[model samples]
Target chain A: MVKTVASVGLPVDEVLEIKKNRILPEGESDGKKKRISIVTGIHGDELEGQYVCFELIRRIEEHKELLKGIVDVYPAMNPLGIDSITRGIPAFDLDMNRLFPGNKDGDMTEFLASGMIADVDGSDVCIDIHASNIFLTEIPQIRINELHKEKLIPLAKELNVDFIWVHGANTVLESTFAHSLNSRNVPTLVVEMGVGMRITKEYCNQLVDGILHLMETMEIWAGETIEPRKPIISEDADDVTYLNAPTAGVFVPRVKHWEHLKKSDEIGWIIDPLHGKILEKILSPVDGILFTIREYPIVDHGSLIGRLLREEARKE
Target chain B: MEKKIIYEISSLYRDNFRVTGFEFGEGEKSVCIVGNLRGNEVQQIYTCSQLVQKFKVLEKEGKIRKGHKVLIIPSMNPYSMNSKERFWPTDKTDINRMFPGYDLGETTQRIAAGIFEVIKDYKYGMQFASFYMPGKFMPHVRMMQTGFENVEMAKEFGMPYVVLRKIRPYDTTTLNYNWQIWETNAFSIYTTSTTEIDKESAKEAIRGILRFLAKQQIIEYTTHEGYKSSVVTDSEMISVRTKSAGIFDSKVKAGEEIAKGQILAQIIDPLEGEVKENLISPVDGIVFFGHNDPLTYANTAVFKIISGGI
Candidate 1:
């Protein structure tokens, strides 16, 4: 079922609208089924989630009996931003994610945020999907906040991602949609994959499977659970060490995402573009996993170009 | 005797960013001054860069006291500054708001983490801060209301007003609040402008910072006596706002004392040539902040006055 949940525009002019795709069980059950929400395109530039949303709906369409509960998919939150290829809301230039649980009486952005929170409030679990920004390409990862680690880990591990990063409390803003929803007792998972403005077909399909597996874990769906392909993990954000450029120059990357690294291994190099001299050789500080590398060559002093996650042992 | 590369950041683009700081009297980390963290903060960058130039000469003259070191990072977020942007270029995030940051987080968070790793150990920190609003403020020293706040220490800088702010929930992530939490006496010095260089206010700011270092016995240089700052709470100030939106005409400037009934500004209708509203000073005190934007919005704060007896 599709419904125009929120809209804005004059009666005579073009009215902007947002539609929610609700997939319900095939037949009326004895009891109310649990609801799971899948959100994507909060950042209008991240296109990978849109494709995943499409695939999820397609699968549900094909096998209606496999779905035991309702699936609410907000395929694109900022349609105007997506239309313009901008990261911020088209008219206000505000980041919609930062204004979650917004005031209905406030400005247009806040009203929209408030409406969105209301739309997904009672879901048993919520997923905020995103693609990495323009400067970097990332391995598929599920990032869960540390405060909800124990409550979220089992489900996060079931997400079939390459890595799971549990962020400290301060890492994610309280105003963010994930935090707001999670704080309200709705378990939330943030999935980041591929790159901004473009959809990685491989990552999209992989994440769709993870989402399905999560639904199965919650007993909301009867489907084959997909195991993680690469399950390297970090206990929390503290387990990550950052290597910054000590000065400005062109950065030449020496490593790729998901690569294992030894202590003092050269991760990248900073070079003076005009003089063509080697200014600094950046190195990994610990024996860990290199999960991120700056894709852009130009860096300012103190810009973080690389990050390594200190590995943690898995619980049997 | 010369500049040193304190930190470097390599990016995907054609150029690299460097945080260049001048080092003097290498001993204990006595003080560290940070310049613009935002791109549009040209005045803050200019003030810190001038201090760097001055300190280079001071280091040569042996005026930096023994067993003390001073570091001045003139510019940190130059990528945004190069393009005159107000935030990080790629993500449009504010670096100042990500203080004591997560090393594994986004770009701004990582940048803040790198600097905090270095400067958190310093005895004192000074940032040439700009206001969130586009306006001119009376040169002052601002400190957060962390348990470590020292209004007396702030007065040493000799700015006109020493304002202490209660830590808001959102302020916990700012650099000033984090520095205090880390045991550094962090003070934010706001000059008159953000993008435009106010040379007079900039000179006063540089002098005030040096005066602070001198007061701490970190340096032996002689300087003029600065303001015996009136320590004010953030709540004491009254904001004078415009009732109508239009082209603004101000009758008073920043730092000028005003009476309760005096006219502060007039909002003129942009399309129709007529006075829409006349804003009056409601408090008998000095103008602590003045709106510099040419236009005014209805119900917008145009000036912040230090309301009290003269």
Candidate 2:
């Protein structure tokens, strides 16, 4: 069944509405059933979660007899952004993700955010999905705050991601949806995958399998489930090395993404297209595995080119 | 006045990024004024420049108090300001948002950490801030209700209004909130303009700051008691929103008094050149803020009015 989570009056006699798809156990109206929320599209350009939402519902309906709990899929949180292909709410130029647990008495955007948070407040678990910007491509991974490590890391392992990054807490996290839900003890896990403005079917399929496995673990689904792959966990901040551009130019990668490299290996070359000369040679600073790589070719000084997980940290 | 480089970051391709500070008096860290963390805040930098000139005269005449020091940073993000970009030119990150920042973090964070480290221990912190929306504001002093905010001290500025905002979760990362957390009396002063310099309001803001310094005994200068500032919370303000997306024709400027049901602005259709909607005031009040942009989106707040007279 479809339900409107938030509605606000817009211009031209228009109304902006956020809707969600709720699937429940066959013929069961029990309010005590465990519920999981799958949320995405906080950024309109990140559409990886759209396919996952559709696939989750389609498979659940296919095996309706085995469903035992509630599943709510909120695909488009910023519908205007999705419609206009903007990263944030088009007219406001505001990031929807930054307005979590918003003020009820504030502006229209804040009211909408507050309503959405209230609607998803009491879930057993929530998976907040996101994709990288158009400039970068990220492998399937889950980012967990070190503050919520003990309670969240074990749950994140069931998501079939390639890596689990346990990062230190920052003031910025207090306004995020996952942080707000976790503060409420809802056990929200943030999943980041693929690149913005494009969808990778393989990553979506992997995440779907992982979500089903998680559902089975919670006894929300009694159907068959696959065992999720064990993910590499990173806890120390020093274990990751950031690669930034040395000069402004066109970046030409010489190495494949996600490849292991030794110290001083050539990762890429920043070339001056107009001058026909190599401006700078990008190299691996340490023995590590590259997990993040820039997708766009344009390079500016101080632009992040990639991130490498130290090899020793991986072994640990 | 002595000019000094407070923080510097060496660059390979260009001149090093430097945050420069002008010191007026030489004693205890009494007050620190920061301006234009973003590139487009032309009015803020201009206000700070005027303050610098005023301080030079005051310091030459020995008007500064003997036991106090005053520091003014006119512009923080000069790299972005040079390129006419609002944020960091390379990554488009906001330096203002990265307050009390991480030294080993990204470029903006490092810059923030560098600047904050030098000015965090002052007795009073003043930031010339701009609104997120492109608008003109009645010159006022704003404080975040962070339990550490001092509304009494804010009123010393003698601005027309003292706005106390209920702190939100995201606000914890802002410079004013962090300064308050660090036990410094922090306030954000908003002028009538941001990108363009409004001479009248800039002078008003300068007078307000000088009055505040005199009140705190940081300087021996005397200025007019600007206003009996009215204390108002952000929630008490009424927002007037446009019903159509079009060219906005504002009927009243910021700081204007209006009656209930008064037409505040008109949204004119771009193609047909006809008024689509006339935004009317819902309450009799003073306009605290008014949108200054040429075009506005549907449902955007065009004016913020403080309901009722002070």
Candidate 3:
């Protein structure tokens, strides 16, 4: 089934619409069943989640016998932002993620946010997928506000992901869709991977499998008995260390992501673009495994080009 | 005046990003002024730059009293300012929201950490802050209630209003709230506009800061006796919301006195040019904030009035 989330009349005699795809199990008996919502592309620039949405729908269509619960997928909530490849909603020029639990009678962005929230309200488990910003690559991971770790960690571990980072002090956590949903007692896992405006097929497939496994574990689908994939998770923000640019130049990276390096290992260099001279040689500070590295090279001073997960940084 | 680079941020193509602070005097850290943590904060940055120009002359003329240090940073997010982007261009994050940041954290976090490391120990921290909502405000001094809040010191600014807001959970990451938590008498000065510079308001803001400094005995300049600021808690403000969405034609400006049931604005249908609804004042008071945006949303706050039975 398909539904229009919201519609706005455009000035040029056209209409802008946000749509959602809903998939239900066949021939229901008694009306007691679970519903899981998989939302993605709230950020118009992050498109990896769209692929996961497609894969989830495709797999469900192929294996109808294994499906017993309801699946709702919001592929692109900000249709105009996604269409224009912009980071925020068009016309309003606002971040939809920051306007969650929105006022129904508020402005355009808030109206859209309210509709999106209402569409997913009362779901048992909600999943928000995202791709990292355009300038970097990321391993598939789940992110939660540090405050929600005690209640959310076990739920996050159910999904197939490489890392789980508990971040601190972002006002977005109080206003974002996942956080608002969690506050309403609905558990949500925010997944991130790949690069913005692009799709990582492997990451999408991995998360799709994880989602299916979680469904089985939740007894929504009784066809297959599945074991939860234990992922490398960190409960504190300090488990990952960021390496930033040292000078203004074209950065040339020497090591790939997910590679291990010793302290002082040469990871990259900043070249003075005009003079073709070496400006600064970037090196690793501690013995750690690099999980995030800069894919797009043009950076400013203090720009994050790499992130390292320390070997033994997590608190036991 | 000595310009010192407090923190260095590495860039790939442009020059190394640096947060530079202009030092006026050389003893104890007395006051630190910051502006433009995000782009679109033109009024804040403009006001601070004017103060910097004024402070330079004051320092040379021996107006800055001895044994007191003053620092003014006109901007902390020059990259975003250059592009007219409100947040960090690459990551789309807000630098203002990352206060007392972690050195090993993300890019914005590191920037906040670096800037906070230099200014956190000051006796007073003042920021020319823009409102989260795009609107016009009656020039005021605002302080968060952090248990260490000093409302009396805030009144020294002599702005028309000294607003006290109990901090919300979201405010924990903002610079104003963190400064108070760190024991600095922190206050945020809100001017009239965000994107456009109102020279009149800018002058008024400059005078207010000068008045505060003179009151604190940090400077020797004599300024006009501005308003004996009225302390208003956030809860005391009465908000007027729009009943319909359209082009908003405001009949009242900020700081204007109004009686109950007075017409404040009219929402007009943009296409047909017909009046949709009239925004009337619900309380007899002074306008604390008048929404400056030409277009308004239905049920959105357009006017806030201080309901003092004056």
Candidate 4:
């Protein structure tokens, strides 16, 4: 059996010496086919993606003969986040994922990103895996630039996920790995599923299968023929309603992630832990899908509790 | 002993909602001590307050033989303390990071400026702080790139260790960097993390302060039996980072030494019933502070190993 991993970055010592970041790759395939790079663990605390990548790596290793092209995998881009179980590097308090393409001499993130990005360069496709923001539970989905619908829509379909959100390129700046890769003319798909610090096996399985499906479509791996998943492409993805807490209390969410709700549906209630009084009962403001819900209970006034995916009726 | 309540900054509620800045044992040498910049750092503020009360009684009896004017701001961030928060009430900003604070900025900066304004006349300054996390810390003095005078004075503080470091500015812009700009001798001292208070750390801090006083010839340095210290430079400190995010299974205790690559802890994936990584010691040294909570994130510091022999 061919060993799957290409390299593991040893921690760099400082002037005298200090152990720094770690990076793991999938393989150094001599095959000249178009390549795909699946990367995760930029924020160590957001581990759902890490599991997904591991599963893919295992499958690729077990079936190496089926792989037609190189699939470089960097399991963790930020070891600091993984070590601390935090979204940001604890010591410097820097967000590793936010430091895009990365500076060679900057902080730890810059140095790590530079090396990781180099390994990923020249790949035909890139998949930057991430968990949802800790504050919300996002449906497992692949995000692509809305403008790239002509080229990426079919590719998104091949992922076999629930949603293929063709988001605008202007959503966030080129400060993210996916954005940086996309800017470099590589077709990139940013995958987001589950929530930070917690793993849902169902979502992880979904992402693993989706990545396999994409590999199969690119002819990198030959597997079972997958039925293409039709996605609910939102035209106005930015018109999202954010429900905030009215008082400081423990938020008890009634709605689950990916649930559909009608207007006035009781979503959650904030209860005062000290007095045992129901502080506020949040109701759905519009007939929409429950896109997100806050998992951590401790909430204050103005804390974003949930978000609604507004539905726009199809034109005749 | 002139007893009068002086307001560091006028409170929004009332003028008397003031920080009781304590001035003790007046002389040629002056030292300013501040504590409880974060409201969650209750123990630190309480200790400073108790120290003030102890000195006040001793001064009343004409017992404190110090020729230095020691000023204590027991609770600098009163608003946060009142709300029982780590940051200010309006905006959650750490007050300690607000160095060389603005006189008229946000809540945290204003508090920093007001505190700086009161301590500006002092010859030497020491800031007291508690960590956000819980752990016992060795009494060490931290100074930025200011110079050796502060380090020399820190030696006089007679703490167990004198830690030299350069860190990015946060809390308020008026912190260590600001103190450096003023060309004043300063040190930031802490017992441990934010939550738990260690009695030994408190004792070390108080002892260090007393030692500094004695070294200044303001008081006599009395050596406590069996409480000797080992001095280590910044380079000697080793930080042990966790390899994975899981429930940390720490096999080694702090203050103990083990050979290089010895199993210190295991980051276990509870669901899979598998040990993700076996975190081993990178250096032969004593573990100063490790993760108090078993559950930790990846990239979190599991142990601070000091290499120099004690």
Candidate 5:
């Protein structure tokens, strides 16, 4: 069965509007069990998460016999953003991700966000899928709150990702979508992968599998036994290194993404295109994995070249 | 002599209030030229004042003859004009949105009604405007009603651009919108201004209004230069938005010719501090309006480039 959540303005006078597409279980006798909900495409430009949601829905539909608890999938929470092909809905210029637990009577985006929060209030768990913001390439990862360590950390491991980043409640504030859900005592996790404006099939597949693993663990799916995931985990408030360009020039990188590096190793070089002068050589500050790298290379003063998760440098 | 007055409401109360107007002639083709309902548009006031003063001089010199008692209300939002705001005191509702007036509505609605009541009947109406929206727009005449005569008058204005715009029928409070309800011919002349009006655009708008009045025979004036085009539509106005959110740095100017695929602007990453995306013109055209300021978010209209026509 399908259900429609009428937001502030009665869900846009259309029969097949996005908000109207809600999937309920086939023969669910009980509604007291905690339910896991998944959402993607809060930002229009981030398309990979939407693809992941589609893939998961198809897989779930194929094996309906395994379904038990209710799982709501919102593929595109921000329809206006998708229509305009923009990240933020143009009417109010507010980011939906940041407007969670929003004012229902405020501006347009805020109202929508608040309405979504209200709709998902009693859910057992929620997962928000997102892509990088049109700048950096990212490895598949899951973010959990440090405060909800016992609840989210176990689920993070079950996600079967390369990295598990435990984000402290204080560090991310209540501005993010994950924070809004977590604040309501909901076990929320933010799964991020792929670069902004681009997608990787492998990364999307990983995210889908991880979500399936979580579902089976909750006994929502009575399917075959799934393999547990071994993830490289880090504390929320761990030491991190910011790699910045020392000189103003065109940056050309030699080190590839996810490459294990040593201290003082050459990561990239900045060169003046006109005179062929090598202005700066980017070197790794600590021994760790290159977690992320800047894709676009026109560098100015104090531009971040890459971010290295310094595993060797421990806190004093 | 039915006299005109500027009620400097600043003296009457703490908040500012004033009435702007002009009156001349008496006859069959009565007209009123009101302008700049939005604030941050001082150019319309200047042009209307100049035109009314011209009519006043002709009437005083005894050279005036025939057609229309003209009323020109130059700048309605005197407080906004003074403070460089686009809307009313606190509501920030566009005065244009508050049409046909409301007795119990907001400040903007009340003012809109008062202004409408003053000039409901006129044979032909024209409203002068300058860009208060954060970009440079070309000098053009916009009208709602259909008919070759309205287009002809717009052409007669001799502006470089003319647009036969569809003023949404629901918006009946605007001067042009109201004039249409009263069965009067109306057009809006738009050019450039927000904090400051561009001089060349201002001159072209004034010249267009003069040419329009001349053809109406309200005052005998002549112009040898031909109009750039007969008219334009809302479809012709192509608005270009940014693809990414960041600090915007522009590379082109309004009215400058641009090639297809040429870089128009670049969005710099606030976190990384580099040019992340370079916005380019998808079609060959002339830049109509580009944001002069650098700080802008993604998907916001950075420029409006128009193509075709000489």
Candidate 6:
């Protein structure tokens, strides 16, 4: 069943609405059933989660007898952004993710965010999915803050992602959706995958499998689940190396993404299109696995080209 | 006044990003004024430029106190300003939100870190800030209620109002909030306009800053006494939101005295040119803020009025 989580009147007799799809075990009373929410599309340009939402619901409906708990799917949290293909809210030019735990008495955007938090407050678990911006493509990974490491790391490992990056606490995290929930003692995991404005089917499928496995662990699903792959967990900040463009040029990749490399390996070339000259040869500084690569070719000085996970850290 | 490049980042295609500081006098770091962290804050940078010009004359005349130093940075994000963008041109990130930033973080964070390192330890910090919404404000000094905030100090600015805002979670990352946390008496001054220059309010804001500096004994200058600033909390203000989305026709401007039930604005339909709604005031007060944009979306706050009493 579909329900409107929040609605606001727009000009010209129009209305802005956020809706969610709720699935419950067939013919069973929802009394005290464990609930897991799958949230996505906080950024309009991120469409990878849209496929996951569809696949999760499609599979759940296909086998109604195997479901024993409640599942909530919130797709397109920023519907306007999705409709217009903009990263932020269209008219407001505000990032939706930054307004988490919003004020009920605040403006339109804030009120909407508040409503979302209220609706998802009592879930047993939540998975907030996101995609990298248009500038880069990320391997399916879960990012956790170090403060929530004790509670989230074990849960994140069950998500079948390639990497679990535990970041140090930052002030900006207070206003994020996952942080808002986690601080409230609501277990939430943030999953980042693929690239902006496009969906990767394989990535989406991988996440859907992980979500099912998580549901089984929470006893929310009674269906068969696959054994998820062990993921590399990086807690130390120094375990990752960022590759930045040395100069402004078009980047041409010399190696495939996710390829393991030795030190001084050529990863890409920054070439000047007009002069047909190789301005800079981007090389790996350490032996590692390339997890994030620039999606868009245009690069400026200091633009991030890719991120490498050190092989030694992975082995540990 | 001595001009110095405080923080700079080399750009490959464009000029190196430089945050230039204009300094006056030569000893204790008494005050630091920042302007235009966002690209579209033209009025803010303009106000700081005027201050820079004033300080140069004051220094030449030996009006600046011997042991006090003042630094004024007119514009911080010139790259975005050059491209006519409000935030960082490449990443569209707001530098104002990345306070006391991390040096090894993203571009905006690094820029913020570099700027904050030099300006953090000043005795007083003032930021010419623009509102999130495109609007006009009745030039006021706003301080975050961070427990360390001294309301009496804010009143010294002598603006029409000294607003004490309760810090929201998002406010924690702002420059004003972070500066206060770092033991600096920080205040955000909002003028009448952002993208466009409102000379009258600009002059009023400048006078307020000058008055505060003189009162603090940071500069040996005399300026006319400004407003006897009324202190008010954020809860004392009432917001009027539009009920319809259309071409907005505001009936009044900021700083106007309004009566209860007064028609504040009209929402006119775009297609048929019909009046959709007339926004009426609920209380007799002064218009503290008025939406400056021509269009209005449904449920958008068009006006913020200060209630009848403090």
* lDDT (tens digit, per residue) of candidate 2 on A9-102: 6544456889998898988774689999999999998999999999999999999999999999999999999999988777566778888888
Candidate numbers, best TM-score first, in rank order: 6, 3, 2, 1, 4, 5
Candidate 3: tens digits of C-alpha lDDT, residues B154-193: 8888889999997755688899988988888899999888
Ten-residue stretch with the least lDDT total in model 1 chain B: B7-16
Model 2 misplacement above 4 A: A1-3, A23-34, A57-69, A219-223, A236-254, A262-287, A296-303, B1-31, B56-70, B79-84, B121-123, B181-184, B216-220, B235-253, B258-285, B291-308
Can you rank all candidates by DockQ, best first? Answer: 6, 3, 2, 1, 4, 5
lDDT of 6 at A277: 90
Identify the runs in model 5 with alpha carbons over 4 angstroms from their true place: A1-316, B1-3, B6-12, B56-64, B103-106, B130-132, B145-149, B167-172, B270-273
- Candidate 5 lDDT tens digits, A116-142: 788777777888888866656778888
Question: Per-prediction TM-score, please?
Answer: 0.70, 0.84, 0.88, 0.52, 0.50, 0.93
For candidate 6, what is the lDDT? 0.90
Chain A TM-score relative to the true structure, per candidate: 0.90, 0.98, 0.94, 0.86, 0.88, 0.99
True-structure lDDT of candidate 2: 0.88
Report lDDT (CA) for all predictions. Answer: 0.81, 0.88, 0.84, 0.66, 0.69, 0.90
For DockQ, the strongest prediction is 6
Give the TM-score comparing model 3 with the true structure, all chains together: 0.88
Clashing pairs for model 3 are A248-B11, A248-B12, A249-B12, A249-B13, A299-B12, A300-B11, A301-B9, A301-B10, A301-B11, A302-B10
Stretches of candidate 4 off by over 4 Å are: A1-316, B1-17, B27-29, B65-67, B131-134, B169-174, B225-235, B272-274
lDDT of 6 by residue, A30-121 (tens): 56799999999889999999999999999999998888899999997999999999898887889998888987777888888999999999
lDDT of 5 by residue, B1-310 (tens): 2457533323112344777677777776467787677775677777666767766776776534575577778777776677766665333456665666653343455567777767766777888854433666767787765442367656777877777665332334455766776777777877765456566776777677767777777766667565656455766767676655667788988878888899999888766778878988988888877887666644456787777535
**Steric collisions counted per model:** 24, 0, 10, 32, 3, 1
Clashing pairs in 6: A11-B245
lDDT of 4 by residue, B8-61 (tens): 443323323356677778775477777777777866786676668756775677
DockQ of 2: 0.25
Model 3 Cα lDDT, one tens digit per residue, A1-316? 8889776544333466788887778876435579888998888899999889999899888877788888888898888889999877764556778788887766557777888888788888999998987888898899988767777788778788878888885664688998888888888889989998788899888898888888887766656634656677776666777798865567889998888888999999988767879888999988888888888777666678899988786324
